[model samples]
Target: MCGLDHHDDSLLEAMLENNLLFDSGVDGLYGRSGIFEDVIERFELLVRRLGAPDKATRIHFPPGMGRKTLEKSGYLKSFPHLAGGVHSFEGSDRDHAKLLGMLEAGEDWSDLQTPTDVFLTPAACYPLYPTVAQQGAVPDDGRLFELSSYCFRHEPSKDPARMQMFRMREFVRIGTPEQVCDFRESWLERGKTMIEGLGLPCHLDLASDPFFGRGGKMMAISQREQALKFELLIPVNSEETPTACLSFNYHQDHFGQTWGLQFEDGRTCHSACIGFGLERVALALFRHHGPDVEKWPAATRKLLWED
Candidate 1:
């Protein structure tokens, strides 16, 4: 299914068989088992330890965010195909009755729900911009935040690395261009080190977002040309092509301009973020260390679970 070959299909089946993952009958939506979730939590703790010195402000957001904030983020302009809006039944009892009738008749009823004022968050850092903007100008030392959220994208695939709804852990920096660029550069190496410490081989490469449509092609090209994005790749599903488990992005004045974020000097701030794909990283660990946590390397287990 979904153009998956024998090898890929087998790998997916193995995960299912081991009880690390549960198939939800949807390609990109699956339930994580207890062991799988434990791995993710341990990984997050490791990340916190690695980043403790930064003293970044920590924030957690839910799966959905204000649609107005999303509009200001320009997500629709870049990746409309991957965006998801939340809808609910905001109709009268008559409409509800009709919807129930349709459901009983085995017909469409989802249309009865009107679009809500919120949308599923596309990234962990999308809401930060507007929040910071509301707080006023940035300090001279700049702002750094540790943020995590359940991000949603509409791209369904057999490749387990590309989940439609997944958790993203991000370290966002907002400051002058020099400060933000430095943060992104430093995280490139930090990301590699973090993944390698988990017993997974990883490499950093220049990358771009999967922007949508013809115009998006140009945006991707420009992003690559400007060296605005980088990803830490690992062999989760395939050793040859690899998958991106972490990303470092430098949004030079993009979010600042969008949200009217500024520095004390009255110049727009620059922004950068380091994102970790929590599920993908956990999967990579499982792929390398096997499904049984007891079978994993002692050092790796200690690093993740003990100290």
Candidate 2:
């Protein structure tokens, strides 16, 4: 296999065997089938309909974000290992000749690549903070935004649920601590209900972002202690290690401070966001309801297919 040795990746094997996922000859990367895409689209539409009453401002972001924004966000300090930086070949004619020679020789020609202004976005909400800050301050009542993007993480795994590139559909709230907290709390229940309605077995649990390094251990502990994060878990790959298909988070002034986001009253705004891992959710559906949509429970199909 492409850069991967023999491993008992049961879910991945099943997906490949049944033609639900087309192999890219690489681990953690595959061509999603049309059936998979349909599920994701229907799920997202259902989410939008359910969230309509919230009147969140819809904002779509590309898969890449500014390198400066990523730097200022301190992502490198916390999760540098997961960040994907873009590099480009910015060279002259002579350099091009050398690069061609290296390619022919099968040498590592990527060292000549220069860092580009863009980096693959780590989360759907990462770009929203800076965008809001640029607009000056949040309103007294607070602000809410709906965002979606293809996020990139460096970790490659044998589990089909863990893809390096995936879609994250998020709803973000910015305001005082109370406002943000309320949003996360509501979403925790809402997310669970949505998943349960689809007939999948799931539960909500306290969770933390996978922070990095020695200091990150402390951060992770603090986050859990404060209950800053919660995840809607479902058994996609295995029951022992349930996949976090949905997450509700409270970012108590971290993004506010980094992006200089402020409220109309001048105090820094607190923020929270709920992220739906679209691909993971789809995979979970496939796992629980069978790869063929026609064979799924009627209620489940109606929930996804009906207007």
Candidate 3:
């Protein structure tokens, strides 16, 4: 079986009952236990080990990325519904006193919150573009970067696999069109194999990003029709609508134009990226292989936990 019958909170309840995760009272927001964290850490180690041969330049960023960068990426226009901008109290002393009074009087004062320059990064690769453009030109041979970030989206869900805040480990490639396409095509199989190596049944499907609004319908359809995006789905939540555990995307000069990325030959660069949802992978492991790590399949255990 791919996963338990998840008509209710059976899996979430089981994990909570077993101390694998702690309820945060909010749906899609849970405090992971140490055991859960260990699994994620070891899985990331496996990802790094598998990707190490590529010599990707590793970079890390905090959960919040520059809001200006996000704006320039066209994310605000395309996925405004899902994007999350950090807001803070940027008011004067009188405003602060009013906020305190509101709290004391049981009034909602969130209206006083001000938008900050930092936004919760929607994707791991969002912050990499402008940073690379700032470096002047892509190397002659091309550029591959290893990046990971805590990303946020506004979608709240009861599905444990779909968290509002999650971490994505991504490998991004920027180069000629051929190079970018090849990178995306290669990873479609590589990512599936890696997930299967962890003993999860997975399949690849042409997919589209969750673009917002009526106009976004056309955008999503166009994305799928162009075969620009794909997802590696696992039966974590249910069979009908399985979870997207990993995603592969190809941006044909979109980011290049936006960020002014250019190759050493002065040609516009194309980019591709493959991202792994670390939490969903762990959840898949737990859902399929049983909650207790001590009793997991020996082969899967060896693949992920071997020293």
Candidate 4:
């Protein structure tokens, strides 16, 4: 209800009443209803089936990652505002007493908590870089990983498509420039086809991340100019401006140089990743097909529920 316009409020009510989502009474943080979880599971299975021939290495990471890796990933430089650091109480009994008093009095008690070694992961691919770098060099054909994680961002909005915490399923490829670039390009089309198969109207478009400040603005422009990022957008909340349900990115030696990732040939490995926003995609399906899962199109139900 916080700053949500009439349209968003109505949509939120519908979703809540349908039991597709459970609001935490906080913007951007909501619990998934049973149907939501079921849909996500089916979607992930569908994604895995689509990529089965690729034989990508599957890896699932926890919601948080080491702060050091986040630093090394250069996330702070670009998305400092969106990054979330985990913190916990690390004080003595006296501090605990004070914290309790403050909490009881409805005063600020967060100061007692200190930052931990881990930070909430910002992307599905962030932790993969350091782990891959530890392996020394990539193989001749390079490495491909299927990664998924719950990513956290600080941005909160009335638009349900934009959530502070959401799951991202990504396929990461590392190899020569051509190899990585080709991987990204292939997924660009593949993503479109998969979404279309679900009967969702979508389009791939040139896009860039929302960078932080003045310097970030320049970085965003440079990224777009280099054609490094693209997103598959679908109309979720509005038709005029669509939400990005999937994204493809090419990091030309940026991560390689940062994490010492290299090819067997003594050259830095270029990397590309295709990420699917699981929640957004499910939400898109719900918006398009209406709330009742049993009433959805026969083809859609068969595709999701049947083999």
| Residue 115 miss distance in model 2 (angstroms) | 1.0
- The predicted structure with the larger lDDT, 2 or 3, is 2
After TM-score superposition, the amount by which residue 185's alpha carbon in candidate 4 deviates from its true location, in angstroms, is: 1.5
Q: Model 4, range 30-108, lDDT digits (tens) per residue?
A: 8888888898899899889988988999988999999999988999999999999999999999999999999999999
Better of 1 and 3 by lDDT: 1
lDDT by residue (283-303, candidate 2, tens digit) is 888788876788788888888
Inter-residue clash pairs, candidate 1 = none
CA lDDT, candidate 1, residue 139: 97
TM-score of each: 0.96, 0.96, 0.95, 0.96
TM-score of 3: 0.95
The residue-by-residue lDDT of candidate 1 on 208-254, one tens digit each, is: 99888888899999999999999999887877879999999999999
The regions of model 1 sitting more than 4 angstroms off are 1-6
**Poorly placed runs, candidate 4 (over 4 Å):** 1-9
Give the poorly placed runs of model 3, Cα more than 4 Å off: 1-9
Q: Cα miss at 274, model 3 (Å)?
A: 0.3
**Which segments of model 2 are wrong by more than 4 Å?**
1-8
